[model samples]
Target chain A: MSDRLAMEDRRSSRLPFPAELGALVAMALAGLLGYLVFPDDLAFLTRLIGIVFLVLSLDLVTGYCGIATLGQSAIFGVAAYAVGNACLAGLVDPVALLGVGMVAGAVMGLASGVLVAKFQGLPQLVLSIAVGQLVAAMANKLSSVTGGSDGLAGISPGPVLGIFNFDLYGRTGYVFSLVVLVIVFVILLRFVRSPFGLLCRAIKDDSLRARMIGARVYPRLILMYGISGAVAGIGGALTAINTGVVGLDSVSFERSAETLVMLVIGGAGTLWGALIGSVVFQIFEHYVSAANPFHWMTILGLMLIVVVLFAPRGLVPLAVSVVDRIAPRLGGKS
Target chain B: MAWTVLGVVLDAISYGMVLFIISIGLSIMMGLMRVVNLAHGAFAMIGGYLASYALKSLGVSYPLAIILAVIGAILISIPFEFLLYRRIYRKSDELTQILLTIGITFVIIGVANYALGPTSKSIPLPAALSGPFDLGFRMIPAHRLFVIACGLCTALLLWLLIDRTEFGVRMRAAVDNGDMAEALGIRTQLIFTAAFALAIGLAAFGGVVGAELLPIEPFYALRYMVTFLVVVSVGGAGSIAGALSASMLLGLADTTGKYLAPEYGEFFFYLAVILAVFLFPNGLLGRKH
Candidate 1:
């Protein structure tokens, strides 16, 4: 009976293919579709891809780890500045700039993680906002390095593998960002399913219970924060490389809030929701602003209220539930 | 140097007063309901815009326009309190509350932007309060004097209302423990609505009166949100006296920092907030849960 139970458990866990691989294929297909459909607006789409990465990173901490923060943009902005300034000072290789961004992001994550782990609820929220604002203020004040309100410009990253140049049409940037996103998503998919990830989830469910089970909750959260920061940094670096500029707006409170909104709209904790939310929001924003720049905010605001009131678990989860109800057999094992 | 310091102090006091008026309602609401109303600034912005419109388009007297704005804000908030916020009050999740309030804030901002244009609108000060007044050592703006007076009067009235009245007692009981307050036969929901309306009225009054200091614009709601949050958090969420003191302290620090180092003012301000939160996690006067 024990042997049969072990066999059943293994069968339940096993799949036709690794889930990460399937997700990667689906993501690559989506990228191809995006590229094929909007060849003219690849630049905007590329920028949106970069933002999607930031939102995904936000999900890792706020979603999986249950650390409520509005300062993920702080790390993103810091890494962008690091890469932009480094490139301006002769480090033009795309991979090298990404490395710089990742390191800077990790450092920021560790510092902020300590503060976040120390407090609960409102204090934690206030601290995160303060830290984000502080970093933005510093960046603005240090005009010599960051270019202040004018923004850091003249970032010219070299080709990826010396084959595709960063072009004005954003063709190369689009493919480059898509590849990086897939890589990061796969790594995160694995990370979130690991034993460590389960421990983090347990902590989120109940930190006291996790501690009672001897989980050392604070250190685990801090590590998760650091990883999330690195992911955000990569996104920021891609933005710098794609746009060839980094502005103070990148780290502003507005960006932080917008990312959080996207995460909530997509469904927190579920990784795919991040991408879905960002895509829908950015597309809606683009068209609406293009048509009526003045009233777009009203529409967006109404959408937010409706989403929160009606579908608190977000669109992705709602979609999954609907799919399950429609075809129980097809939804099996997901 | 002494004169400069005096000027800074006076400016800080008047500025702090406006902050207190706008934030007191927020402090009370948070204390009583445990709801983080991020839309508080948006309500204040509406009041400012309404008052400005009354002065500009309706040709109403400044004092009458202020009163009208306050009434209008309360009337508008009543429906929201009953329909939206009423439901939110039942759900205790902080994130949901934050999201709901933020949605309301965004809608307000959008409406303000569409209705009042993106440019800043100023309420025309009456002739009596338009110019400077002669003092022993220096000239002081009459507008500043009026603001200071209003601030003092508001503080006194609010003190009497919250600390010395039966309703105040019920409200405090609700804040301390809602279940117990209700168990004693107090209709906490009614108290919450009344308190919410009162808070909205105060915010509108402050927004109209302090338009000169803070300005009226579409982004006004988002712009002052952090400042208001800092004030309330540092003051201790529910303590009125704490709000007053925190506002003054922050107001002074802000004024002094801007005067001394224009470039690093925000840096120092946020740094101070970080250190304050780190040292006093529950705010200066907040009780640990």
Candidate 2:
């Protein structure tokens, strides 16, 4: 790494912790403190964790992998149905449901990857939209299984890991989600830092160059897409278990667009952005909706316009700039 | 069975005709400017609404409404092309284009949803256009025949304009090589403005022609824009013949699905689309520029 990176790393570690570690600690402590102080806030945190996982999944493919997709919500919707279906069948085992979701999601990802990896530009975007609409239609058509527009419910995930009981407040769900988020983040950190990750970024930067350099772009992209699907599936499954409800929102265009916005706001290609971006955007969404349900889209739309026009680099880039400015003032760097 | 099949086939053709109108312009834009306008549907909606107003307020015939709507769309799109699209014409990255279009789509959708209530409305088809025409095999809606006629005439007009006319030649030349066309004193700006206007006029005309089949509602344009643009993708962007072929194919597929099995219908069609795109990644008629 360059000296600037080293100094940034050192700066990240100044508080006797690595950056992600520090962030995780801060979150856990905040969660614990909120549990003690607010108590009711734990459920919200759990939902936030679930939302964060979604943002993370989006970041994995879109931000880090550089694959601009519009159909991830389809995979999320599929996983949700899987989880809810398994639950309705009395298989309330979270682990098994998550695994099933992951497998189904991975399969969809691979299928979509084949379609998308070879295509570029308008065709790809159109295909992605088609994927989302197709899934929505499937879910709508198989109303007998998916419960159609009414959505699936009556899911009582009695306990998580058979140790922590799912209480009235969903404390177990919250903590379980937090643990999963941390574990997934660690895996994703390792994955993105790997050679495959480098190749994906290279493909993103200059696909022609990556191809000329023998990157075997399609297979790598397929792998990345599969992982993204798996992550999205996990997020979906967790959402089903936590809320005890699964609906058409999983495969919605609005959800896909929201996740895209979250990935941008948080900082694409950075793991931390997923977590922070999801939390921040969800809160913003809740507030915007509360202000005016029908017109909130206008606000979110304006934000999207602003970000693309002015802050195309996203929140992470803004953060990096601020840190850069502060470093010299703190006598840390030139 | 034959009656329904014949009816559905006509319905499909009409649907395809509308998609052809909307996408031909989009395909042309993609060919000439290499810019994907996600807001093409908005222009279509504007046409539909304007036509509806003309029919309701002025008591104008459907054909007159369509003409007025097309004119309105042309006038509207020229300004948009000059202000927004002209700036982003040279950016090579699709992602940037995607973002710009998405932003424009959002703003338009918002404004439309705000201004136009969410309730769906339909343009009044005159008795002449609404009549059930007697085909030798079965009866078909007159409006359906009209849309098909409109599509055929537009295709012929476009071909002649591009291949036979000086303006069309200049437009095609500009599409192929913008710099060269500019250097040759082709007055590229006027050509671009005219192309933009013509492209949107087609969308508006389609909007009025096909308004009865698909009702105009808030954000209605944006909802089906992607599906329509798939024609441009399938047929070949900038290739008029390609747009026609793709629209007809997609229209037939959609009609067959809705007719045969409404429940499992859309599912089957999209599955085919996914498969088709996988096999032909650039689209059915895609050619490297």
Candidate 3:
């Protein structure tokens, strides 16, 4: 089992044409297909792309680095609120606002990472929850700034590159989100394949062994957290722009928990898992909730339990295994 | 000023007792079985709902309602233990346990909402407990006194049960070394199931008792999950004394913080938690392995 996991990690991290390039192509096609299929629901699609980023960031620390955090929304929400406040403060430029969000997210991530990297297991989980709750409490107490429970609205961003305006139909926002999602995905693909990423996996597999081999474990963990925060920040910024508001929900415990669920539902520790999980969970939720809001949670909960029990590795890996059984030539490529 | 201070302290102690009663089960389970059972709160919710149902629907007496709630919750937990928990108990990884338990919690919350409606359920106090009782200097609600007395009795009984009985010795042996205890002719599996049932029963009792403070809403499971987790972690898992002190400490901090500075809300409570966890990762009374 350990050997197969290690081999799978190697196959994923290697810049193999079949896995990495193919995944990139698949992501692009999926995003475009989403845009075409649901042109009228551009806002929801844009918001989903934002969540995709958040889950990818979560995959970085929790899946790859062996961190058990339930408070990821702390970083994501901080960056989002930063961009919202910036836009309100007359920074209407979309690209520049995203940079603000990224920096804000990184700062919060690094700060949280410093505290979180020192512990393991249950204590670590509690600490993360504390951090997330602290941010949320502060946001609530300082309601004058955050708009309190009503959320900060009236965020108006100028078009992409000062060219395309954010239309009522959300066309510009959807395209903008898609383009940014693709760019981040490509960068993360390379970032994970880099030596730093390999060192992270090594630390995750066995931190004591990595330390014996002269790796600075805590520093690397902190750095990975900062990178993750930046990715989450982009997602936060996109949400701020697309929704034209940032609310307490952005930094909520529920959001953090939901994002983790999405990550696990698709699979964890793999880039494809993060992307597919967010997409599938979000789309499933959209349809299910619309059909029956009352029983949707029960259905979702049942699905989650089944996923955990039957497909502990998540849907993406389960699909891969099934495909491998049917078509050995195609399956063996990865 | 003295009266106000006394009132606040009494409220704090009562509130703290409720928290302790609810979270001790979670603490013991986490410490002993090494399972992060997020659904523990759901058991508490079930207890609260059952007690409320008994009181309002069946017109049962207060003590009988509490008893029924505890038994019902334990009975309900048996299937979950056999089907879901038995499978994951031996796994080395915490992630699978966390995910699977979280799935259980979601299902419980969803089902509770669907069956019982989303409105909050209140367990009304009996006429005897609802009235005010006179202290030498002032009057206070008898319910607060009742809750505090119940908490003290529970703590004492639990202490004796774990510290004095033959079952306690076996439990400690299993906790110390499961394989060794099994080799010594102890049924570790049976001990685990019994312990789990005990934990669930206590959770139900706490829920019924704490309904005044926490309320029995559909979202109760998720809302108070972090609170219960904080108490257990702060108390040091498996350490009854640790759980007691941590609950009292947090309870004091939260109640006093609210009284002294209502504007601050739960800021101080969460801040204190962060500082506490950072300072002592193993918790106050946790035994270092």
lDDT of 3 by residue, A129-208 (tens): 89999899888778778888899999999988979999999999998988888888888887886789989999998999
Q: Kindly list the per-residue Cα lDDT of model 2 for residues A264-330, writing each as its tens digit.
A: 8677777877777777788777777787654776676667667766667677777878998888888
Candidate 1 vs candidate 3, DockQ winner? 1
How would the candidate models be sorted by TM-score, starting from the highest?
3, 1, 2
Runs with alpha carbons beyond 4 Å of true place in candidate 2: A1-17, A29-45, A326-334, B136-138, B187-190
Q: List A-chain TM-scores for all predictions.
A: 0.94, 0.90, 0.93
Model 2: lDDT of residue B145: 89
Q: Rank the candidates by lDDT, best first.
A: 3, 1, 2
DockQ (C-alpha based) per candidate is 0.75, 0.52, 0.73
Shift in Å, residue A303, candidate 3: 1.8
- Residue lDDT tens for model 2, B105-217: 76666666787778886797788877898787767778888889988999999999999998888988898888998998988878877777887888888777878776798
User: A194 in model 2: Cα distance from truth in Å?
Assistant: 2.3
C-alpha RMSD values across all candidates: 3.0, 3.0, 2.3
- Residue A288 shift from truth in candidate 1, angstroms: 1.2
- Model 2: colliding residue pairs: none
* Correct interface contacts retained, every candidate: 0.70, 0.55, 0.65
By DockQ, rank the candidates, best first: 1, 3, 2
Q: What is the lDDT of residue A323 in candidate 2?
A: 93
Candidate 1 lDDT over residue span B1-289, tens digit each: 9988989899988998999889888888877887778889989998998899899999999999999999999988887788788877634666777778888888889888887789999899999899998887689899999998998898889889889999989998888888999999999999999989988999999999999999999999999987887888888888888888888888887788778889974887788788888998888887765
